[model samples]
Structures are given as structure tokens and as C-alpha cells.
Target: EIVAAVESVLAPQRAGRLAGRKVLVTAGPTHEPIDPVRYIANRSSGRQGFAIAAAAAEEGADVVLVSGPVSLADPPGVNVVRVETAREMMAAVESALPVDAAVMTAAVADWRTEADSGHKIKKDGSGRPPALVLVENPDILATLGHHPSARPKLLVGFAAETDDLIANARAKLDRKGCDWIVANDVNPETGNMGGAFNTVRIVSRAGIEEWPRLAKEDVARRLVGRIADHFAGA
Candidate 1:
């Protein structure tokens, strides 16, 4: 009762922090085709990205969610653009540019077939597996990070790693030229991927801030608070 009362009083103040601000978020896993019927994809579930969109909306930010294949419904009050491959995701990002902030949470594939077969590859009597030629996909985060005109004031990229999480995230921040990087250990043994909860760290030029394990929604809300504070200071 007391918590609700306090929240009710603070709600307006919180909501107004991001009023008139525009934000972009990318989520889920891009599927890169190998053939007409087969593709390669990652394990992202898009839960964290959806939660971030909801949190930004709660703070009164006009949010655009560019999503890969996921079963989740669109976050209320967010404009969602659904897509498949990494190239498609990049196009969507370009279309929604000139925002105050951008969050890249999508597990975009690193490589895709150079030329996808028109039809599914079939094995002949030789009984040998088909060989696939792969080419690197566009680096959406790096593109926005280094963009001259379309870069947002605040750019946040994510690094889901299996080992040396902090070091790798810091490296990613420097390499991608983003202001911040949210790093998490997504080892299947930890069940962070496709799981309800997450434990993560926020890496920036200032330093790293580690967070305890919590629901994906909680993480989103906290991140939104920081973003709001960032704008307040600006």
C-alpha cells in the first residue's frame, strides 16, 4: 500500500523525464538463409528487448522496436517493425533513425550464405553433405555506432558472451564505438538465453556496473531509469 502510494506520486515525474524523446530498439535473432528451406539463427528470445520497449514507453519515450523472428507480442505503445535477416534489420534501423537513443539487443547472425540455393540441396547417391559458402552480414550496431548523421545521442549495444564477459563487452564497446554495452553470460548451462531471468553488466567508457540476477522486466525498468537520468543531466 505504501509502495503503491509513493509510486503513484512519483509516476508523473518519472513519465515526463523521457517525454518528447525518441528511442529505437532492436531485438531477437536474425535468421540467415543457407537455402530456400534452411537457415542459421541464434538463440535470442527477444524478451529483454520487448521489456526495454515497454519500459521506455512507460517513461513516455516514443519507441520503435525493430524485431527479428520471435513469438512475443508487441509492447504496448511501441511501433514494431518485424523482419528476418540481418540486412533487413539494418534497413529497418536506417528507416527509424534520428532518435535520441538506440538499443541493439538483436542477436544478428555474423555470417549468411553468399548465395542461397533456389531449392533445398539434395544429397545424391554419393551420400555426402552439402557445402555452404558463408559471407559476413552487415554489422548493424557498428554501423549505427559509427554513423555520421544517423547516430543517436545515446547508443547502447549488447554483448552476450560465453566467457570473459566483462573484457569482451568492453572490447565490443570500443570496437563498436557505442557509448555503452550490456554484457551477459549466455552459456546454455546458465539458462540465460531463452530464460525468464538474466544477470548482466553495463560497460561504458566510465566503467562497468554489475547487476544481480533479476527478471528481464526489472532490468529493463532500471535501464530506463538510467536513460532518463542521462537525459535529465544532458
Candidate 2:
């Protein structure tokens, strides 16, 4: 209901700007299992990416959403692919590629336990805590952005940061080889990470587009509209 109302105001009534275009969007926090009973995850709720999927669909694009373990319902008119770990998400994204554009908002865990126990680790009388070894996870964003054969024309990444947001986003653009970066302050105090509203700055080689705080649905609509422009001008 809330998403519908918000889209009413922001989304175009009938825009086919992205007609026949294929867009891929990744959303939510991927959980990396440490053990049979434990895992690592973040605070992402998947609202933003779902909204983007909805908005893209509204623009007449064929949208494929590769999502993490989010509780939210799948957006209408979009094909959704569910995943639990960063590796799974990476694979799903790759399989859905050859897309016209991509928006990666999944808070993929940077590291995962090097070896997860087949069985839950039991606490023995050993007073010492079990030492956990972690290894860096696959860099999905970078991999897709730099994919020579299947790279999307426009690859967008999200940088979740607490400080020096713009600087970090700019660096991410180069590091990830993405065309644009949506940098947002996710400080819990700001209530943006898992919140309904967002205040984001779009960073690209062209410059920065500082958007005002808006409902996540609104942000999605605007971003999708921009994506339409990107393809139209291409």
C-alpha cells in the first residue's frame, strides 16, 4: 500500500523509455554462514532494490532482481532470483547478465568463515573461545563491472559509509569499475540503512547528483527514470 501510493506521485503513468531493455538489480544483505547455526549479515532490508525493480518495470524494462534473503514480497512485474550468500548472489548476477544496466545494492559480506563446520560447533569444557578464520568473499560488483564480455552498459554500485561518504564513493567508482555510485550515509543515527527514506548522492565521472531525502520508492522512480535517459542517450 505504501509503495503504491509513493509510486503514484513519482513514477510516470506510462513511460516506455526503457522498452525492450533488460536491467538487473541486486538487493539486501547476504548472510555468510560461519557454522550450521550461525552466520554473518548486515542491516539491509531490500526495500530500495525492490523499489528499483518496480520502478524499472514501470518504465517498460525487463527487470531481473537477484536478491538476498529478504522478507519483503517480490515486486510486481519483475522476475526475482533469491540467494543467501555472496557467492550465490554473484553467480546469480552473472547468469542474469548481458543486461543493459545493473544496480548493485546488496550489502554483500566482505568476508566469510574460511571453513564452516558441517555440524554446529559444540561448546566443550574448553574455556577458550573457538578461533574463527575468515577469508575475503568474491567481489561481485567488481567482477560484473569489469566483465569484458557481458559488462552492462551502465553498472551502478552503492557505497554504504558512515564518514567521508563522497570520497569513498568516488574511490569505489574507480575500484569497482562501475559507471556510477550511490553513496549514502548509513549511520544508524541517520536511519538510512534499513529505513524507508534515503538521502543519496549519485557519484559518476560526470559529477555528483545530490538528491534530497525522499521515500525509498521515490528514489527508485527517479533513478529508474535516469536509467531510461542513460539508454535513450546511448
Candidate 3:
């Protein structure tokens, strides 16, 4: 049954379309520590990114996954590097160089505490909440897209938005210097942020392609297929 399932999952790509391509993927939410026991993070389950990685692997790409803190098993035939903080994630990604494509799927924390207290901070008798200093984290997508060395030929980034989805996604694609931006509305009612299904638009310099709502795994397969087509045409 397991073998049959695997065959069904990969049957569409029996042509070995991406046979020897190298792809890198980032997943999960970076945990920014405030203290020994406290941290800040986003609501990314890493399922979408993991699914993409698996699809790419099944298409015959040599895959490298630089994942943030997530409790998931590594997919078969893919290299997995587990990391926690944003800084660590960035470092791991930079080290895994010279790939054909990169997918920035991780919902990285935009900011982190400026001063990470090594010791646990305790409340004083004043009954007032303590203040926190915030610092911006490096935009991993922008960093990799504009890297001086070993920049991937095709770079993809995700734009999770609540309003002005297409406009904001276009802006991000321009700002981040990535080849493609996958935009999705993550309104709480839509249940997209950590849900099994998604509805998204793929924005590029050419134009926007609105994809149908589908399971995350299906989305991954379609995106991987597009990536394979991109390389073939390039």
C-alpha cells in the first residue's frame, strides 16, 4: 500500500523532468528568544514548504531544506538542516550554496528582541510589565536573492497578507529581487496560515497567475512543475 501510494504521488513526473537540478527550501517559523524560556514566533507549520521539498525531490532534484524549529521528520533523499533562531537559519542557508533554485517559504520573524536576556527575567513588585527592545532581522529572501556569490538562478518567496494581496506581493517581489512571489491572503477566517489547503496567486514580472484553491501538497506539486518548466525553458 505504501509503495502504491508513493508511485501515485510521483507518477506525474515519470519523465524525470528535473533530473539533476539542485533546489534549496526554507521552512517553519524562526523562534526569536527573549530570555531562557520566552520567545517570539509566527504561526507557520512548515507543511507547505516541506511538501514543496518532497515534490522537488520526487521530481529528481537534489534538495536541501534549511528548516526552522519544527517537529517533522526529514523527507527521503533530501538534506535537512535544523535551526532555531533567525540568525541560525540564515547562516545555515548561506552555507548550503550553489543551488539552481531557492524557495523562501519560512514565515520568518521580522523582529527579535534587541537584547536576549540569558537569565530568566522576573517581574518586580511594581506590577508593571517590562519593556522590550526590538531589532529587525535580516530579510532572508532579500539576502539570498541579492547575494554576491552562489545566487540561485530562480528565487521564490512567499507573501502572506491580509489586505492588498496582489499589490503587496508585487512590491515584495520587486523589493526582495526574487524571480517569483507566491501571494496568499491569510485572513484568520480563511485558515490559510497553518491550514492544509491554500489559495494563492503567483506573481512575476510578466503577470499574475491566480491558482485555484487546492491542498497544500497539490500546490507544491504544481509549483515544482512550474519550476521544472522554468529551468527547461531557461
- Please, what is the whole-model Cα lDDT of each candidate in the order they appear? 0.92, 0.92, 0.92
Residue 145, model 2: Cα distance from true site in angstroms = 1.4
User: What RMSD, rounded to one decimal, does every model reach?
Assistant: 6.0, 7.1, 6.0
State TM-scores per candidate: 0.92, 0.92, 0.92
Candidate 3 root-mean-square deviation in Å? 6.0
lDDT tens digits by residue: candidate 2, 75-190? 88899999999999989999998999999999999998999787898777888888889999999999988898999999999999999999999999999999999998898888
Q: Which ten residues in a row have the lowest lDDT in candidate 2?
A: 11-20
Candidate 1's error at 138, in angstroms? Answer: 0.4
The alpha-carbon lDDT assigned to residue 105 of candidate 3 equals: 94
Clashes of each: 0, 0, 0
Clashing pairs in 1: none
Per-residue CA lDDT of model 3 for 1-234, tens digit only, reads: 999999988775434678778899999999999999999998899989999999999998889999998878898888999999899989998888888999989999999999999999899989998899999998889998788987899999999999999999999998999999999889999988889999999999999999999999999999999999999895
After superposition, which runs of candidate 1 have C-alpha atoms over 4 Å from their true positions? 1-15
TM-score: model 3 vs. ground truth: 0.92
Give the Å error, residue 73, model 3.
1.7
